[model samples]
Target: MAEDLSAEIGPDRSLLLVDDDEAFVKRLAKAMEKRGFLPETAESVAAGKAIAQSRPPAYAVVDLRLEDGNGLDVVEALRERRPDCRIVVLTGYGAIATAVAAVKIGATDYLSKPADANEVTNALLSRGELLPEPPENPMSADRVRWEHIQRVYEMCDRNVSETARRLNMHRRTLQRILAKRSPK
Candidate 1:
């Protein structure tokens, strides 16, 4: 009789971590390993897709952006490859439009960037549409405005001048806003 290699971890504890940020991937992978998950990582959608084809993960944590393409591509592929895979989309550029699109494509949940590993594990394991409670102290209006400006700046491909123009704010003012630390 052949011994099952998967016995070391629970059968469904395998995971895929897809993100272009190497540091984030490393940290999350280690944390997931400590949580009994065997996490395999890929920095691009193509690589993630190949990994899924060879061995579908039981859970996945994907970044919204990647070096090669959007992470939604990977989420869709994972869903197609294995309907049971639970997926969470993480983005530093969180916005309602993309979050809705991600869920529509089969992600289990959507989370903003800087989320810790514990939060991710909870998200992956939790069932149904219920989400963790929101942070007691949410972002201030100024912080929200800053984040929205930053999101637009990023979408404009980091064209600061263009972002300032789009936001109908002066260039120097935009720079000042970008330079300041986010409010608590």
Candidate 2:
């Protein structure tokens, strides 16, 4: 049966976009506005919480890592304040563990970075439906490995030595890889 998703999400056009990257947030906020949403943006978890608390947005697009703290904090706060708000967690460093954690914490969907406005819009509107399928030509193996390494590095609090040890890789090599920008 087709679920009545609109009823749960309501007709509110308010959207809260929380991400530290100024360019990314700005671009998305503009695109969301073009889609008829009233978008309010914040760069950190604290700011996101404040915005959400002041007047909970009907929807949210949150980055996994924020300057102040994990974006999950914002998700949790929103869930507490507005259980019906649809949230989509965005992350550059995607991982199975984090995605599972996001959904467990009440995010409506978890999408990797480079997700365009249309993708986010669909996620925002299609709560309770099947998740969007992974792209046919997904990230290459090397890119996936780099993303995983980055995830572990961040999980260990950005300690290169610890991450190297955990990955059983040489410290210098890990550093070299970390220094390079992520693969497309």
Candidate 3:
């Protein structure tokens, strides 16, 4: 699908992938390259910004948080350099506020982490006029709860008490949940 779209956009097909997760970035890069893109990888906001400034890509997938800085900064740089760039903001800790901010700042779409290559490709190539198909197998309620708790825990600097307070959950309960493996 992306091959057809890439063909229309000429041979450039340059894609910038910025994520602090080295393994995820490497995997995505290889997958995207197979789908007719020329990929460039970066592991920090600073490196991403540098690449965006020097050579803006036609397509980009940037993580929401990075070790050096916010990925929004990289998105801003890309938007400034390439007005028509198709950018997707990927985050593990998805929130309405951050999603809204990403769209307001020129992100084409916001995807939660663990999105497969096919999902990412579709998001990149799909026209805004059409609605995306619903996920065939949405996460179960238990999984969703687990994800939310994990996100809150990470936000609280892994302090169980702080996270429990923020979530209105008991600290011991939070600890038990944290100790358990995430649900499928």
Candidate 4:
């Protein structure tokens, strides 16, 4: 991890990290502090929006979904309060449409979930002149689909019928997919 990212830290080192996963956000906040940020954490969309509105941060890492609502709501509030805020939207349920929506709503970048502190930092510091290098081993299409289905299944409380209905998939087909191990 690169130290002394003070150059990238805006007028203030204030950073907001919002995610529903308490452990993950806590760990990421500590990692960011070591990299020279003053991170404030929030575990829900309402809390995140309140923090962003009360005091817009110089940089933000927001989750795409929260217990209360979407993380994009917080992103929008921050952008409205501070036009120059560098915001990154993180999502466990990664999809091209959501990525585009995040960017369209003023997010600086969109990252899939399980992103490391370094990856988030790089995203915050990116100038957009150069494209990021492609992943050494990107997920295969089948793997991506499987991941999506699994995420939806979890989101639907592991109710196969609800998950299948939400995914527009037949219940039996969804069951078959759920029964198998994840593709690499």
* Best prediction by lDDT: 4
Instruction: Name model 2 segments beyond 4 Å from true.
Output: 1-10, 134-184
lDDT by residue for model 3 (33-138), tens: 8888889999999999999999999999999888887899999999999999999999876755567778989999999888988888878876788876786997
Model 4 over residues 38-151: C-alpha lDDT tens digits?
999999999998998899899999998889987989988998999999999998767655676789889999998779999999999888999878879989999889868766
lDDT of 1 by residue, 38-151 (tens): 899999999999988889999999998888978988998899999999999998767655677789889999988899987888788778667456889977887778668867
**Model 4, poorest ten-residue lDDT window?**
149-158
Determine which window of 10 residues in candidate 1 has minimal summed lDDT.
1-10
| TM-score of every candidate | 0.70, 0.72, 0.71, 0.75
Q: What RMSD does each model have against the real structure? A: 6.0, 4.9, 5.0, 5.0
What local lDDT score does residue 67 receive in model 2, on the 0 to 100 scale?
76
Clash statistics: count for each candidate: 0, 0, 0, 0
**In model 1, what is the error at residue 34, expressed in angstroms?**
0.2
The TM-score of predicted model 1 comes to 0.70
Measured by TM-score, how close is model 3 to the native structure?
0.71
State which candidate has the highest TM-score: 4
Score candidate 1 by lDDT.
0.83
